[model samples]
Target: MLRALRSVRSGLHATYLESYFISQCDKLSSKWLTRGLHSAPAEDVAEDAGVTAAVGARSGERPNKSNRNQEVRPFTSIPGPKPLPLLGNKLFFTTIGGYPMERYWESVQRIYEKYGPVVKVERFSGSLDMVIAFRPEDTRKMFQAEGIYPMRPGLGILTHYRSKRPQWFSSPGLVPGNGPEWRRLRSVIHPLLRREVINAYRPAQTEVANDLVRAIAASNQHNTKQDPSRHIISDTLSILFHYTLEAVGVVSLGMRLGCLASTSANCQAQSIIKANIEVLNVLGESMLQPPLYKLFPTRGYRRLSAAQDTICRQVDVEVARRREELALDPEGFTQRHPFLASLMNNPDLSSQDVFLLLIETLQGGIDATATTLGFCLYFLAGHPAVQDKLLKEVQHVQPEIHTLQGLPYLRAVVQETLRLRPSAAARSRVIQEDTIISGYCVPAGTFVVSPPNVACYDPQIFPGA
Candidate 1:
């Protein structure tokens, strides 16, 4: 029965691949219908991938979903894992089998088992699609400098906004889409992400990290009897968010959020940032599945859209205020050290451009760094030996601001955490033209997903994947 099933599935895959290749050339019209799930469209197939795309996939069997003899371009020619009907290889991701995070990796590996290097999965609803890459080479293809493929827009809430003014709700730089305006913003703001600027931003980063340590220490001292490893004294993630936002604001506009000193956050910026976080949490899940998910709206979505407008308007106000300030004192303003001030001297940048760049940088850098800190803590709690080694390494350094440069083990821990808990689990690209990746002919605009989570755990690469 297994052999017969394989035979049937192979036939269907062949037809599917052939049909997709033809569709790419404008040779065939691949009419899509998402009724009762007869033919699972490519987008649906990608979403089913989820975290499995980000995490690595293990070996598994490919179930046959066809009764006819169809030939898919062999796996040797195409680069990704094999697909199963409607589900693609996503069914291999089993959420119930292991610890929450580990289970995600297990499920991903299962897809790799059946599919091979690159596998596609359908997220439940019309949320974005996913692609899991088993090989490092395949993964590297995604980071191409040319904007042929950029990041995915599946981060959810960033895409869904209810605002009257476009400027009011603009993301600036955080969300991903390709167009002339996006390109204009990217060109002017790209310099801020340069290596030197990231280095310049580190002083603020170290200050924040030290503040976090002190806060944690104070809490631990107060709860002397509690286990340091297990006690959740405070949310380090929240602290990091404020720190990053304030850091960006200081660097970009010479403004301060005053988050580090505040005992309780109550500012408008704080409220809006908090609300945005809530929206992200909601949109992230809501986007995972398709139209059926419409049956339920999570609290993240339930929050009145009007509040979102309030935040955008606040951003616009800041933009306008900065512009007026720049006009009134052009010479002194250009000399200012703030990020926005620095951009003022650049002929290519406008006030709107500066605002967008600053906002986007703040949005992208904050949650990602905070979440990363949390993941680092989680690992440190679980692996004391690693923590001890890191501490020892830190101690050997002079503890000066420059000391961070020579800390290898500290860097290793950070790298390991990033690998294990990437800020963005999956990176996506839209195929611009008909292309053959790993031998499969992918049509233009068909969302191509390559999850990085799997790369972190690959045993051949990471040794314990």
Candidate 2:
């Protein structure tokens, strides 16, 4: 019965392919008509099976007529790993933990070593297109492909409630989708992330950093100064979270989280942000297990929702307060460092758009900066010599992180860290159109990804791996 079904399907596919090919010929004919060109012979058309297959695939049709003498050519199917029924390859992926990508990295390399550079894997209902580029050149090809060989949809764990918070940092199009909005936001923020803009934040950052240091010192003072050895490793993430809130506070709303003082005070706002971020961590982790996430109604989700609501309400209040303050002194908008204020003053952007942008920036800034800085520390810790080199470089300018700006080695350290342990490591996008990679002709509308684990570790780029 299965054989019969296959046969019937094959026949249908062949018919579809023939119709698709005829349509392509029509298109070609239309183009040539303007030049007064005659139609090519039938044999000429028949010889172009690759072109026919491509056209058919584009039109959502298939050619199942004959496997014989046909150019399997590049990739008839996007290759991947095979999986067991129902469960797929979930078990295999889950068994290897602590940096999901690392395990996948190892598996991908092993598969490529055994088979070739590109292989296929079955991931639940999805088919994963895996590639192990052993050289920097191959890595460049993948990155250069960008929109073509883009990051995959983040694991389900990271996407929970992503849509719920339109005000979410991810809302600025940073969450993952490939679209005009994403492009727009990226353009606006990239310049701000440049060394000059980052340096602009140094005054504020140093204030915050000093506050953190002071807090630690005070804790030790309270403890009778008996060898206070808790390393002042700025939870780059937490600090970033604080810094972002404060930055947006001053720039957007003419307010400040007063996080420096708040950290010591453990105020309501500080607690709320911490709670929400923690909830994010929990939810993000939970997204890994589909069944478990589905079966259980965790307290973390409730806490997260509550935290978000609280934060949003607080933001609304802050906005209202700023409006009243601006009413008293109209020049405040121009005078203040608030980014949102400048944007608000702009005649172009709507108030709603400005508000949404502020929220996205604040939230995204909080987490992303910290995650990046944390990852940098992670690499630095692993490579003590690298850390030592960095420390020596910083010694000449100790306590002046801004001086490290544009320093080649410092920049390399940061870039290398991002390459190795990206904060938002994996990403996903729907294939916009039919595309080819490593000889695989993938159909449009399919979800595709370039896992950083694989991209960063590509032997061609990093070599030693």
Candidate 3:
């Protein structure tokens, strides 16, 4: 059954790819012909016209040394959707439901296809101007030129919440801040999330995975006769959410919430999972829409506030419990969970700071890990051959708690999934200085977005995509 499904999907994908290429060829032909370069191929025309020059243009690359000091041109001259009197592309983004942040990749792709790679998009009545770059070369340049302290734009609602509760959160954690404060927090916790450190927690992670398998089996006991491909549990995302939250909780808080247990349905563990989902949903909406919460206490804003309080309160309780245990026997506490103990021991970070940090870490891990795992399962379910191969590899290794090495096929599956459907579809960076991207002058203070989805689909990079 799965094999049949795979065949159908492959046929559909091929059809789509063929049509896409044909459309692209038409676009290129028209563009080149308009320039009176119809005699040569589009690639040749692009090469002769120095289309790649914009990619490599930078301050130090100038041949004329005397011309390097001149002020660069502004980014306003870039072509984009024309702005109206008050609404700047906001109305275009609006639908019957709301702003489409959930489907942001689709929106970005529409803009990229319509206005070309380096198109400008204005939001919030032109208060926010963003330059969207789809080409891989432009993305490379943007990251390379990002200064010592690379600033990632985050949800504004989170910043507002943190500010309201100043006593609890002294500064925004890694997600919502830049400059010295971000650097300081990142420096303190960076080592804890390093590759080696995370690898050490593999034993705990495997235990959680095992628990998840049991939970799924128990939940689907009544539907055992159903075809594996058509099983209801296969389509449900809640199981993945629970599994990821439990796994991340164990790693972050040095304890399990039993989120995978059958009896955890109405418990505090379940409540925490629900709160995390709500926070993400509310924050995503708040980020795309107007900040009406500041002017009036809106329902979304209120819900976000409640979710934040729930998370912070729970984290505080856990931190207090750990502190009490550490005071009782510091040596034993350090032996059990040295990673978390080390963070608690840091002199610079207060209790509230540690709580806020844990909240950010857990929230970040839950959504990304869950989404990735969900995609992996979806892909593997459709490709039983690959699944069988992976199973054989796993069986051969008889992978122990912390021993996931020598799993090349498993690693490839993950890498390929990320390449195809990355958790972070688009990344934004605040440009600190004037820079040339694809021949366009993108000035400082402009928000620049690089869509990995666009680059990932490039035939040149990933042939046969």
Candidate 4:
């Protein structure tokens, strides 16, 4: 989840931060496994513009001015939610749950309102302290001044876990990687995201999406029988998640998880889905609280370890089966398992590295895609005129679920949904240079961040982008 997840500084809010996790180049802007999931809101994955921009930011447009000699005030001058003695903003953030964007955004809104645009959030009185710059101009400056190896303080718990087990992870397998090793792992994903790869795997995406439709239909039948007027599918989010998991599995795991079965979803499939939920919840917990587990194995750390172990074991079982299928028909493997085939066949990457990438992407992509789809449905339902236009488009392209093009209205609706409801409140980057952010000359190593919810709704900012 490297460059791909970074919301664009150029107009559109690309959904970043906790709302949107992981920024891998392969999670294609528009051309991902979730593409045909209701013909959802997607960036142009084949174009891979974000990947190129990310790589360029790291390789070409950097080695930025390290103004060690500049006449700037000390970094401590930057203001944020004040910290207590030996305990920074821990008390303030303990109540800030990372999910449900509005809840987290509410806290951020208060901070922005109190501290103006740029506020230094002193979390636990350590280097973990962050400076949030709330303007688009400031955000663009951070990216421009970000050095070659722009370091993001990704999941600290995840990085710590991987450090303890270097045998299984190659520089944390892109989730928390940095420098050359991070680039090496990221390189393999770039080649596999071409139009041919996306085109080859459209069947799998379409197949799972169709299964979702069937699941919805099946549920509607049961619901209509129970109460004639209650025709809607109960637990819509759960069904959507099943579809997203199966859709992502097509690429991430290179096999079906039976998540969208005609009858009941199998036990193993349900467990995998549950395991992912556990991982996301733990991640949110780690962010809310301090990382004391970094020093020794805390109970929370144990929970994270167990969840990660479950995902790893499950992925290995599926990967081993895929390898067997590949050995039987080597030539057909490329067409059948485009992404996996590339990863497994690569000499530079280890087997462990490949599994880590797939599992990470699977964990990273599913919930966000499903949630976005859900929001798209909610907004469409509320506005029948817009919904009717989209229905007409879907009908024109329907009968054949794979013919996804020519639906400008669907694309427009998805784009609008993401703009209105992004994946995360904000994304963070540690500035490597002494840069001016929101008029303050923020020194090197300060985290230049953004206020997530404020930017999207403010008419004066985007002016209906």
Candidate 5:
């Protein structure tokens, strides 16, 4: 039967194949659907062979042509590990307590190696069903199937946290949200993230970058060793984080955060940065671990809540400051910081919304940018030829704030680095409706993940792969 379907699939066009697959799936599962027999354990369903075979001894119903073809098959038929009863593959994640959770990427790679391009993993004892795809075609299917409002099933813990603080955030931000609220929030901030708006902040970004270089020079001078190689910034990631936070803060809040300052004068700014880092760490753990934090006020959850408060308080102060400045001298404020002023002018955005938006932008932008920069540095360090080529291009361009655009090779290096080690390694989407992928039926509300780390290595799509 599967062989005949494959033969027909080869001859049919793409659009026709979709309809044909759906029809086949319906025909295959019709008996179980008609008999209301879809609630059995997947293992039992697989072992039963057919409805008649499972119950025929008692009911004396003989296997007919229509009923025989419509027996519901186990989800395990779709190429994955043998799920353990109701727990499914959830135990796979919790095994050894922290080993699998800490090295999740490696674990995922192992699954991909064993199961090929497509695999299913259930979470929370079959409460959540996820289909992970490593092939480009499946990735495209997942994305193309997203209708007008694409739904991303983000961390629910964060959503619950936000819900508790109505005064701070009237609604959840883009990350832990979906549907109309997500759409409305996205549209409100869309203009601020546009090309022209980002380009307008080039001057500010250059200023922050220059300050960073100066700070690095100052720090290097303090090193007793004269050797260039030994004159390393003790914590390079911390320095980059400060640089990125300062840059993002300036662009988003229209204020210099003093993150690169050598002195401890900007205590509040430094505290906010620290809180942001803590928030990210705690949020990541909450996302991976079970929702035990929700039931019991765990230490990690308490820390997360405190960190969030610090971030929100700092952001609120900045927003209020900006609002007061706008009110005092609207014209001068608009001219000095047109982008932020425009956002402030929007009637649709409340002060809390603006504050959350700025916080989200700063939190997301800083760490991701810093991580990407680290990868680029690592790649350049390993590949001297590529580094030398990039150096020559930079020298030729003598890139100033505005002149950086002409260095094609430099841009290519960044692009290649992003392609090779994308900051966002995977993206998740909630299946909004029933869809078929690679001849497998995926029902609505299923969580689908596309791992670019795997797909980007496809030899068919990448010539040198």
Candidate 6:
């Protein structure tokens, strides 16, 4: 619901994260005017709603009275850093000491500045030819071209891994695949967005959060006894990771991971955290690199594979346990575990499908959500006045923060945080048909990368930027 929430220098774990953060609709003082919080004029809100609606539809643009041939420029006409020989634009990425994938959106932003709104990236080793579109109107139009199914074509490293291990990921599950199959798998998740569904998980979520606070208190209490000053110093991120993994475990796998319970650093939960981060980190790097892994198990591929294996094994074990229990009790199991139950009962899915899909939601979702929430807490920590207001509002909301009933500012804070420093920096989709972007004709099947960060940071789009 309102995730990516962190900032418990005192262990603001879980929705103990939930119990703390509050959403208020009142306009924050001049302090938040810069971030353009809830105080925005109605026109801006209306415009944003339009964009959100279009994006939500997830359908592509239809031909607007022969707009396809209305003097639209060729796809090659778009400007970007020039490619050279066989290496092509691979020079900008893949090479040692080249652009790191960790700051990929930065690279895209620079290209946006140098190449204007529509930038074409050509001839990267394993990547489809890409067009980086920056303008908002173009963004709206591009999504319109998405037609019935939006195709996002660049998870080469992941597709490669799952391809190798056909046993686990029979058809790449959902994350890296597209078309009818992807749409069907994705459909099963839509019901999860319902308020009733989220409400059902509230008690368990609260427990996980309380456990997070307990874990933090326990660790800091131990360290402080060793040295009174140790209380002042804490690996906040590490503790947050424990909470996030455990929280994710409750929702995704319908169980507590006991990450907070594990005192050992080499615990399975700790390993999953480590391996999960690596998978994301290296996957970003490999996406822009040469397709060496295609021919053989390159070092990056091997590393990704190993990390995936670690995550997959855990999922496999859980799936087997669930399956056995499911056999013994079907309806009871479904009532107890909504997430796993949905997957377990899907006629379209296999045991492997259940495991792989859980891997995405459990491990991958955990890393991104935790980091985002960490940023949110960091922002609140810097602005004490904002924190004070939030505390007052939080108390006002009392036990209803999850519904976000009275928490508009809290929602604004998250929105602004995501705009400023999002975990998923780049949003992309492969065009399913010929599309018009910034007056240029982008061919169907072209990889389109939209850097929302660039747009988010645009002074024109964001009032304060």
Instruction: Give lDDT per model, in order.
Output: 0.47, 0.46, 0.63, 0.62, 0.62, 0.65
> What's the lDDT for residue 170 in model 5?
78
Which digits, one per residue and each the tens of the lDDT, describe model 5 over residues 1-465? 011111111111111111111111212222222222233233222122333332332233442222224433234346766567765666666554222756666777777888787787765334777888775555656766677788986676677788788888878788888889889989988776565665566666667766766665555433346643334444555655677778778767789888888634667666776887787778767765667867877888788789888888787878889889999999999877777888889898887787778778767776677666656555665576776766655543322232324655655565566666656657678877555444355556778887766655545445475
Clashes of each: 48, 21, 1, 17, 0, 18
Q: Write the per-residue lDDT of candidate 3 for residues 279-359, one digit (tens) a residue.
A: 988977775677777787789989989988887788778878888998999999877776778788989988767877888
User: Per-residue lDDT for 81 in model 2?
Assistant: 53
* Candidate 6 accuracy as TM-score: 0.81
Model 3 / residue 296 / CA error / Å: 3.7
State which candidate, 1 or 4, has the greater lDDT. Answer: 4
- Give stretches of model 4 more than 4 Å off: 1-79, 96-102, 123-125, 164-167, 221-230, 262-265, 398-405
Consecutive 10-residue window with the lowest summed lDDT within model 5 = 1-10
Off by over 4 Å in 5: 1-76, 95-99, 123-126, 221-231, 263-266, 396-405
Query: Arrange candidates by TM-score, highest first: which order?
Result: 6, 3, 4, 5, 1, 2
TM-score of each: 0.65, 0.62, 0.80, 0.79, 0.78, 0.81
Model 3: which ten-residue window has the lowest total lDDT?
Answer: 11-20
- Residue pairs with backbone atoms closer than 3 Å in model 5 (clashes): none
lDDT of 6 by residue, 1-465 (tens): 124332244322233534233111112211233243333343322121233222322243432223233334455667876777766777665434255554576666766777798888786544468788776566665676787977886588889899888778777657788888788778877676466666666677767767766766766533456754434315656766777788778767777888877535638888898898889778777766667899988999989999989988887787778788888998998888877787788897776667777887787657666666667777776676776666665544434334554576666676677677655555578777666676566767777876666767777657677
Q: For residues 1-465, what per-residue lDDT tens digits would candidate 1 score against the true structure? A: 011111011001111111111111110111111111222233222211222221222212222221222222322243443445565534333343221333444555566676686665444223334445554444333433225335354444444442223654444244644556566666667665454554444555455445544544443323337633334445445554665565555565555556656625448557756865765555555443342323444354455244455555666676677778888987665555445666766787654556556556555555665555556556676676776666666553333343323655665565666666655555566545333344233334446665555555555455554
What value does the lDDT take at residue 87 in candidate 4? Answer: 70
